[model samples]
Target: MGRTRTFDVNEALEAALGVFWRKGYEGASYADLVVATGVERPALYSAFGNKETLFLRALERYASNYANYVPAAIERSTARDVAEGVLFGAVELSTRFSDRTGCLGVNGALAGSDEAEQARAALIAWRADGEAALRRRFERARSEGDLPANSDCATLAAYVLAVAHGIAVQAKAGFAVDTLMAVARQALEGWPRSGNTLVAEQRL
Candidate 1:
């Protein structure tokens, strides 16, 4: 058998998570991982396989610790509350920390090398899952009369997530919480209501 490990695995992973969160998958280097985790490359490899694997692990950690608010937001009673909850939760999380200002899922792999395609695809799927969750909730709301039957729940879900992602990008670009909140409000005002508003919008 091999020798026992000296470092805290979870601690190292959290540190690596921070590196990946702040820098992104293609941007984060092995040197960054080593410096952040205080672990040598060999040890890191032993613990988490390779950089891609480590990034995937960090994504899991990010979802559990940080992105958990997405589900909570979906639990709101009203469709407007759910949309607002998601946007509010997104901005709060994106700007909560001074050091890491963007979401790990969004920042992890927006666009990168062909070498990291798997990691990039993972991020896409992760984001798609979130959008799918929102779509389902919105569809239920439509069925319950919270939304107009022709509201195009999937489009509504996509719009909410698009705004959420835009705010995250703005947060990374140094936008303030109040500013993003204003943006969220502006987005909400455009939400579908009665009298043939966005109610007329539908899918192809």
Candidate 2:
């Protein structure tokens, strides 16, 4: 085998992820990553390539490590449960870490500079994938009679994600878990069910 790698790559990546979570893509400097990872820029570069590549790797790690809620929410038997699962999960996640208050997906690139458009696009696509997953789940829910036949699954998905993203923003701004849970509940108030509203919309 080649010479043994000295630093723990997992720990380095985890540290880099924490820096990205707290500071964001454009906001996080090499110095921040260096301090966070306890690895010099040269070693970091040799291990992970450029900053963007490191951030992308961190994104993959975040998805694998933290975004388990997406699938858990999707697997719920009812559409309402799916929405509630994600919304409440977002609330929990956004407030779980005191140091890194919000979501990586929301915080990592939402505040990027114009020069960081590639990173911004990556986060945009990240959220879009979530919306697509929710939309597919909602379509299944509609077929299973958990949602109105005329319910706009795409809109529902977008609405839920919008609220979830909003929760992240608010959490970063120091909102409490109870406050975010209230927001989640308020969002669920508009969840479309399979009967009267459907008939009313049909009649309209």
Candidate 3:
């Protein structure tokens, strides 16, 4: 009979995520994963297939945790509140990490090679879908008269996402949290305002 494995898969994945998060996809070696996850090579391969597969799994786990912020903010706050919260929250999270790893997806986009192109594509698609959902939320806000009829949801969503990406990059570059917050504030200066009507947008 095969020896029983004793490691927690979720915990191992989380550890792997931290390694990948700090060092990025290409930078993270199998040795790093082994050290971080406390799993032997054979156990790691048996659980996660290979390095690329393990990295993809870590990416998925990271995305699952990070992608919910915007939707949750939108769901729990007013349109303006949601906009501010999501942008600032991103900056906060990015700066909180020790290496200031920015965003896993954004880092992956820049760091990935042809071998990891599929992972990069999936990350980009996920980001695009997130932006689309935010756009829809803005459209709903406009339709309900919580924003100006002339407000362009698509452009606004793109602008917000751009700001987020910029913040992520800047954070990775060792930018101060105050500077990122200033950037967020500047981005929000363009938000549409309406009379005192608010609704909690649904979570994604």
Shift in Å, residue 92, candidate 3: 1.3
Model 2, residue 182: what's the lDDT?
97
lDDT of 1 at 6: 93
Report per-prediction Cα RMSD to one decimal: 4.9, 4.2, 4.2
TM agreement with the true structure for every prediction: 0.93, 0.92, 0.88
How close to the true structure is residue 125 of candidate 1, measured as C-alpha lDDT? 95
Q: Per-residue alpha-carbon lDDT of model 1 for 28-81, expressed as tens digits?
A: 999999999999999999999999999999999899898999899899877888
C-alpha-based local distance difference test score of model 1: 0.90
Q: Which window of 10 residues has the lowest lDDT sum in candidate 3?
A: 195-204
- Model 3 lDDT vs. the true structure? 0.81
Residues 53-133, candidate 3, lDDT per residue (tens digit)? 988898778767865687787784456777887898788778877753588767766756787777677777888888898
Worst 10 residues of 1 by lDDT: 195-204
Q: Model 1: which residue pairs collide? A: none
* Candidate lDDT (C-alpha), each: 0.90, 0.90, 0.81
Task: Return whichever of 1 and 3 wins on TM-score.
Answer: 1
Candidate 3 Cα outliers beyond 4 Å, as residue runs: 195-204
